[model samples]
Target: MWISRLSRFLDSVKQTLFILGTGLVIFLALRNSIVWHMQEFWGASGDFWQRRWEELYLLFNQDDFLLSVFGTYIFTTAVFWLCNLFFILLDLTGKPEFLLKYKIQADKNTPLRPADFMKAAKVALYNQTVVGLPMSVMIFCVMKWRGCSCSPADMPTFPWSVVEVTIFTLVEEIGFYYTHRMFHHPRIYRFIHKKHHEWTAPIGLVAIYAHPVEHALSNLLPVALGPILLGSHLATAWMFWALALFSTTVAHCGYHLPLLPSPEAHDYHHLKFNQNFGVLGVLDRLHGTDAQFRASLAYQRHFLLMSSMPVTQQVPEPPKKKSVSE
Candidate 1:
């Protein structure tokens, strides 16, 4: 009975660990080769970066680095919106035959209405322009005042890049967990976080549909704080931000697509409203906030699904369906 109860849990852990290990190994192994090919093809060498970095330093004086700062934010954010659009379009299609099987809350939630999609998009746009842009400018100013490097030549090596990104993820996880939980406080929820939670079964566009204050503090700060504390190179910062955006979008995306991490955990958070606050589930597990989630069917359903089969978990084979002969 115990084994039966834990079978799905163990399988989830195994699948997650395997994916993490394989991704780490592949990224580490291919990193140097990828960098070499990039450098060779672009005719970029140590000298080239040195000059470029120097030029960037000089350019900073002329425009106060506004161009680089805004350009990076805009470019990375565009990727996030494009990802949102992809899933939004899919959801708006009313569970097309092909994707219907992948929908996690298919029975409970209705197809995304065009009106709701437009509302989410409008709020997201408002947050991006009104809250996001100013925050980016402020952060850039602070980084400059702190003497943080934004130069091309200051980029971390591939191995160190991996380490830094891992640290950023940890930092973001802690910040996001606490801030997100704080917003769920009963007193504060109605005023600030309520807008975001309106979509219990969230779609990708709902990822950024939040109060401007919540958007800046809860969403952006957790992510930007890591790079700021580390004073990372601009390129590394952008890379991490892009990954964060994509991952958040995927988390809010209702369907479990192939070759991507499962959206079950965060989707469960939206459905249940008090569980799985952190991005990686680190703090959730640590704080026991995931107790309800783990005990629910959603936890059992979590997996890196690779096929078109309905997402499910392994059970203990039902005691071999003992027959009369037994």
Candidate 2:
């Protein structure tokens, strides 16, 4: 039954792929043209950086600034939708069971109604704004005090030794792993992390979607904390953002990819309400949280083999109707 359903879905996906491929080609062409025009204009001036700054300020005249703000909203929403679509495709292709098991688990275990999902979305938005905006301001102040003119283009060239970035990433990962596990403790779960765990079998949107406190703690630790402690460059910070976003999305996707770890590795923890708290495999392995996961996998494999035997298999029947008198 699963195979038949998957085959039909794939047939539909073929059409989707062709349309998506055409749309992407057009989008890339338009984007590249706009970028080229902007670069040409900037390059014509002898003091290109200075002129570019002037252009930005001028372009952001009160009315334009408002329009730009709206534009940002549209751009962000579009990116999020695209990411969601990609994850849906990944779920269909890599783990058809993801969708199949979702209804079963949600009905059985999770208390996630539509209201809960809305609340989580609100929390995610509020927390990101509250934490990210202040951190950005603080970073700007520090950069100004240090006499640094770190702009977007200069981000790639901003001086931070590779060793420093590497050390910072490791430190941040350790902090994240421990803090995440700590939140799962029964004493703290309701206050800090329960909103997130409400979606036991999550889709991609739940990646950064959490209670305000949980969101601030989870997001700020890796991105803001590392930069502040290490005095890292804009480039390092940007790289961290990319890594964090991509990893979080993949983790929440609930599908295993060839190069990435299985979402089953994390999804089970959410379902069972404990264990497997590490972003990567290291901390979970060290703490023995993965032991049950290994055992469960072995049991499932054995069960599948046994169930596949013709002699052991039996067809389930519809229940008999009850009499009106009963």
Candidate 2: segments with Cα more than 4 A from true spot = 1-82, 88-120, 138-149, 152-165, 258-261, 298-326
**lDDT value, residue 63 of candidate 1:** 50
Backbone clash tally (model 1): 0
| Candidate 1 lDDT, 98-204, residue by residue in tens | 77667777774457777898898899889888888888888888777666666654656655766788788878987999999999999999999999989888888
Q: Number of clashes in every candidate structure?
A: 0, 0
TM-score of 2: 0.56
For each candidate, the alpha-carbon lDDT, in order, equals 0.78, 0.54
lDDT (10s digit) by residue, model 2, range 1-326: 77755654565456345433554566568976865774576456425544554454345452322322332234334445466666554443443443333221234323335565566456656655665455455555564455433333333331233345555556666777787887888898899788788777776668777766666676555555665565554435545655666667666765444445346566667767666676654555555566686566421321112222221123222367999998
Model 2, backbone clash pairs (residues 3+ apart or across chains), number: 0
